[model samples]
Target: MKKLLIALLTAASLSACTTTESFVKGADVGWLPQMEASGYQFRNRDGKRQDALRILKDYGINTIRLRTWVNPSQDKGSGHNSRDETVAMAVRAQRMGMRIMIDFHYSDSWADPEKQVKPAAWRGHDFAQLQKDVYDYTYDVMRALQSAGVAPEWVQVGNETRTGMIYPEGHTDNWPQLAKLINQGYAAVKAVSPSSKVVLHLDRGNDNQWFRTWFDNAKANGAKWDVIGMSYYPYWLPGRPDYTASIDDLGRNLNDMAARYGSEVMVVEVGGEDDRPQNTYDMLVAVQAKVRAVPGGKGLGVIYWEPQGARSWSHYALSAWGADGRPTKAMDAFLRQP
Candidate 1:
């Protein structure tokens, strides 16, 4: 009877773990505060005025992703993801019962596959100082968030670092150096908030070879990360392949990543052309299913990039909000049941 009771208790504990690790339905709203400051108003499907974050919550978004830039500009569309702003936003989202994922761009502007320009202040620093800069900056941000009563569930060391981050010094070609820099960020994150998972992000989620090569190099160089974050934007691919053509590849890659590294995987960024709400909705649904299907539940979640940044406001074509101030039908994809 004691053994039976122990087994039952173990099962209940497993069930509780599963409940706590629910699939994340999230949005990267780094541009939200700027948009709201510029006088943009968000409305629900019924066209009633509403707080933008609340509107997102009602659309089934339970997680919020915000980017942080090192010395950002104040330009309307090109700036304002400073540390203070990020902490404030995280607090607001947390108050609304949303989980937070913090993306570190490590640049004054955007940081991605094509451009990872070093921040102006860090440009002149030698390799050793650069590593120190990465660690100090990451530590400062994490500490600030902690002091604000917000603990990020995931913290990206760098954004879309397909080639590597912090430019020539930290580029993938110099994997050894890049690994050191990455480790600095990872160490800093753990120092401030040990439970927050550190993510090593890359673009092209469907390309398994690319991911394998990059991660293999990272592993050999002793870089550390808890999650493999991917950006899967079919519309942004060179030929603009349809999501249907590559989604299966995404699924296979997600499973392979989980099995290969024994780490959680997440479609940290995804989007579709704003004009085709139906198509975008379908793609989002499929993407979530693929993530959910990862064996042992290693798949963490999907987060649409700046979904509330309407085309009219940001001149971006992938947002899920309409020019009419209402969320596009694509936002409803998150509302669908797994």
Candidate 2:
């Protein structure tokens, strides 16, 4: 009887030790709630105007990525991507049992490679003050989400920081400054939620050389993060005509980066031409295949950037929506079982 009990207990222990799947099939629907607020609706194949989250769930999207702006109210409160707004979206996604990734732009508006405008509030502050602000703000945001019982699975320190974030102060040319700011944000994230994975995001996934230089400098400068997030938008790159080749290289680069860094990699933002939905589908299939093929499965997942932007308030192109407010065939790529 004692031997039998020991075997049963050992089996129970094994079952309890089973690890959850880490692959992330995600979507950056940051504009979703705002779209809904603007009276836009989403529909599935059946033509019923269902909630966007339900549609995404049906498409096999297990994660949601939301972006937050420091002070969007500067534009007459047109800032649906504000802190409070993001928290509300997180609550809704949590109710649906979907994982969450929060992106901090650190500016009043967009903060991509070309434009990293300092928020009005922080424009006059020196570098020291900016670092402290980033730390405090990141900590406060995480605390707020924790207070609401919404623990984000991933938190990005900045968005598409190809050349670094927050302009001249934190630009890539100044790796030390950039690394300092990122470390501050990373420390804040850990302090608030030790389980959440922090991501350092950048654009142009096909550029492996760029990543090597950036990561090498970042590491040498003492920057740390759990994951490397990259954005791949074929239409926006200079070699738009060679997008197919670029897509293929994107997969290879992701694998190389993941293996080299000993860290997980995710295609945090991806979009394709709206006119060629089937082509978009094929691209997603190719990209996802490459990501999943990473050695030891370090490739985490792919995320569509604003796939529901059918006549969105921002008039952004490269969305996966049809004229009928339904997802194009391209979105079917995410339906594959993980």
Best lDDT among the predictions, by candidate number: 1
- Candidate 1 lDDT, 183-281, residue by residue in tens: 999999999999999999999999999999999999999999999999999998888989999999999999999999999999999999899999999
lDDT of each: 0.95, 0.86
For model 2, the stretches where C-alpha displacement exceeds 4 angstroms are 1-21, 74-78
| Cα RMSD for candidates in order | 4.5, 4.3
Per-model TM values vs. the true structure: 0.94, 0.91
Output the worst ten-in-a-row residue range by lDDT, candidate 2: 71-80
Q: How close is candidate 2 to the true structure, as a TM-score?
A: 0.91
Query: Which candidate achieves the best TM-score against the true structure?
Result: 1
